[model samples]
Target: MRVNNFFICISGCLLLVGCAGTTKRPVAPVADASSVQRPVQQPSSTVTQPADKDKNIQIRAYEPSVPKAVAPVHSSAVTSLVAQAQLLESAGDLTAAVATIERALRIEPRNAHLWNQLAHLRFSQGRISPAADLAMKSMALAGGDIALKRDNWRLIARARRGAGDVAGARVADRKARMLH
Candidate 1:
């Protein structure tokens, strides 16, 4: 009986949470079935009719603006974790440092600096592909931080060079130089 009650309580709480999480959008007022107008069926004729112009229908593309460059703010916990990771890396414990950074990332997944740090760590470990990928991710989230993006581009160039793509490395290096 106790187990059944516990399950029932859990189910109810989950249902409530699900409902609370849903957003109520502004719904279009539905016309009554009887009040809705139906199109008249016209007999087939040879006469061509002009296409209907929907004056009320206008389509516009949505363009998202680039975010302005602003320094990222870190919480004390994250700052502490970064410090610890730095210490671990300095002590030749790259694996443990990476793990510590990963923990910080879990706390602030969108932090560009954290992603950049992870990319640098991966680069130091000679994981070329992941290092370049993580650096790209960091650049994507870097907003307008020219320095950070430049650093990421440099990292990507190095990764590309390591992978024997001289042309790709040159392109990345050019991009980094352009930021200056």
Candidate 2:
């Protein structure tokens, strides 16, 4: 009887959560199922880009942007994996969290964010040297992301302090602080 009540409470909570939405747009009116279908307009080879606000006159109307040489990177899967890893870490299952992060890294091996996360977990597990090493790997992959670089430097500083190297820690700390 208690289990049945618990399930009912859980279901009600899930229904409430599922019904919540973030859309700001007005809802459209529902149409009849028997309504006639309208012809879909296919996009032409030419695509129009918004004109610059500063320039009053339009230079080009339909300029096709250069095709991307590579496929777009999808980070949704990584995000989910990261969330799972964080949950595991928060639950004190450091080994499981590290494994989850490793799975995400396999999908995006060059991702500095994943590397940084793994390094942080390593640090928490008292593996200071490997944490610092992973931080350096993240630093190498931190292209155009100054904040990630700074964070890696901070990790390096922490690792150095853990190893009782005051001078190295100070130098790394200075490097991290220098990054604006």
TM-scores, one per candidate: 0.61, 0.59
Q: Given candidate 2, what's the lDDT at residue 1? A: 100
Predicted candidate 1 versus true structure: per-residue lDDT over 50-101, tens digit per residue? 4556334334444444445567688999999999999999999999999999
Alpha-carbon RMSD of each model? 16.3, 22.2
Model 2 TM-score relative to the real fold: 0.59
* Lowest-sum lDDT 10-residue window in model 2: 65-74
Superposed model 2: Cα runs more than 4 Å off: 1-74
lDDT (CA) for every model shown?
A: 0.90, 0.86
Tens digits of per-residue lDDT, candidate 2, 147-176, equal 788889999999999999999999999999
State the lDDT at 43 in candidate 1: 41
